[model samples]
Target: MMMKQLLLSFSALLVFLHFTTILAQAPAKSPAQAPAAQAPVLPQAQAPALTQAQSPASSGPANVTAILEKAGKFSTLILLLKNTQVGEQINSQISNTYKGLTLFAPTDAAFSNLKSSTLNSLSDKQTLQLIQFHVLPTCISLSQFQAVSNPLHTVAGSSEQFPLNVTASSSNQVSISTGLVNATVTDNLYTDSQLAVYEVDKVLLPLQVFGPKSTAPAPTAPATPKQAPPTTITPVVTSSAMGLIRHAALSFGVAAIAAFSL
Candidate 1:
């Protein structure tokens, strides 16, 4: 009975050892773990758009008629420019060359102040010259008139014939004298590097066409001397007449006696 019991205990002990060996060989369960951290997402960069000022449209040549029309109060001057086709010439010059231009714009009121027949009296050629007289070949500013020499040249002709003299006062008051008319600069209508338009109070009448007339004096007549009156001779003849009458009567008496004796 003792031997059988020993055998049973030995068998049970061996079984317990085998089970422990199996548990040691197997992998152990790990604690719960968080997911792998991912890199932060970043937004893609984009290109900036261009602004209006950064990309401007190409501009066209300056137009004198359009400028005067926008300013107002220059109707008569504008009409003259169009009629003479000077405005188109100005635009063409500005577009084709780097040369600048200056215009002296007379207001409608200024035209009204002129005589009724003033514009009508001018021929087509004379009207053209008149309009050209107001424009300078080069642009000049209000302040520049002070330093400019007298009798500035115009598009009309030479300075000797179409002289345009500009004078500026201490108060910056500018005046233009063309010998025939002295016009004041009332306002600055427009000014740019290419062109300048000044509002004048009167028309710029050039000396070539509007000079004064010369009158010659009349000749004097010569003087004449006075004549003497006729003299009277009645008293002087009285003594001679009485002597002759007595002599005639004595001769007659003698002749009568002689005849009676015969």
Candidate 2:
């Protein structure tokens, strides 16, 4: 009876030991445990967009007509420019052909001050020449005029002597002298890489259009030479007076001596 009881106890203890080993081999999980942390989700990167300023810019200069219109004082000038073929040439020069151009624009008051028939009677060709006289084929700024020579070549292309003369004073005042008219720069209207517009108080009259100012100066120059001849005659007049005085004195002496002797 004692041997059988010992065998039963030993069998029960081995069975319990086997279950404990199996439990240790397997991973343990609890209801309160958290899941493994996943990598943080990140937003996808996008390409950067170009801004307005970064876009390509216009390569050409502004239209000459548009620029003149904005000035608000060149009504007559703008009208004349648009109507004439010379305007085409000037626009071409300002935008493409030439490096730039200098425009001497007369104000409305200046245009109004002209003789009643002055602008009214111009032939088409003459009108073209008149406008050409106002434009310089090359670009020139107010400061640059100080270095340019008098009789600067104009777009007129008439005669070499027909160029405009620029005179800039130390006070920074600039005047343009055409052979017939002298116009001073009243204000600087506009200046840029391709064009320069200067406002003038008087209309620029070309010598080619109006005959050279009266030859009155030519007559005055001769008057100077005539006055020189009068200077030469003074000595002759003085000599004649001296000879008359001597003759009178000699006659008086002879008469007085005769009287005394008698």
Candidate 3:
């Protein structure tokens, strides 16, 4: 009975050792791996919106009076434009038309160079025409003047009575000749796609308004007074007078003889 108990204890000890070795050889469970770190997401930048004032479309049409007013040295021209209401017309045309317009702007000095009574002499109708004479119906650039035909038509009528000629020299100088005055384009005051303003030395004088008058024939000298012819004297002989003289002599002789005899 002692040997059997000892044998049983030894077998139980061997089984316990085998189970411990199997557990040591087996793999152990690792802690769960932390998730990979991710980069922070950022919002994309956006462009700023344009305002009404800053937009190009918001700008209105060009103003002639305002342009001249800003340019200075155009006070007289500005006044005439205002008085004739032509500035408004030009502004309106610029805004409405694609054909465009060209203006020959006479400076204050240009107006001053005229006769003192020049502006005053113009009637309302004539003043309107005079202002219109300076404006071309179509826009013309400085370089384009060279290629244009002579006797260019103006906003004023283009009849023979109102002729405007533009001549450009090889030197790129432009000269404006109306029948009455020849003006040089001294400077370019302003220019754009629709409007071009040039500074002219003289106010363009249209032939219809300022042409020379026909002169009357000078008075003829009075005829000299003619002298009267002198009177002529003539001799006259009478037979009756001779007879009376003879009779008187005979009576005298008879009276003398009779007295001697007595």
Task: Quote the lDDT for 123 in model 1.
Answer: 94
Query: What's the CA RMSD for each of the models?
Result: 12.4, 15.6, 12.0
Give the distance in Å from residue 95's predicted Cα in candidate 1 to where it truly belongs: 2.7
lDDT minimum window of 10 residues, candidate 1: 49-58
TM-score of each: 0.59, 0.56, 0.60
For candidate 2, give the lDDT of residue 193.
65
Model 1: per-residue Cα lDDT over 1-262, one tens digit each:
9999999999999999999999999999999899999999999888576211121223876688987898888888888998999998888876665658988999999999989898898899989999999999887777778888988999999999788899987665899898889899987776766677888999988877767656687776766666676786556687788899988999999999999999
Q: Which residue pairs does candidate 1 place in steric collision?
A: none
- Top of the candidates by lDDT: 3
Candidate closer to the true structure by TM-score (higher is better), 1 or 2: 1
- Candidate models: Cα lDDT each: 0.84, 0.78, 0.85
1 versus 3: better TM-score goes to: 3
Looking at model 3, report the run of 10 residues with the lowest lDDT sum: 49-58
**Model 2: worst 10 consecutive residues (lDDT sum):** 49-58
Query: On a 0 to 1 TM-score scale, where does candidate 2 land against the true structure?
Result: 0.56
- How many pairs collide in each candidate, listed in order? 0, 0, 0
What residue pairs clash in candidate 2, if any at all?
none
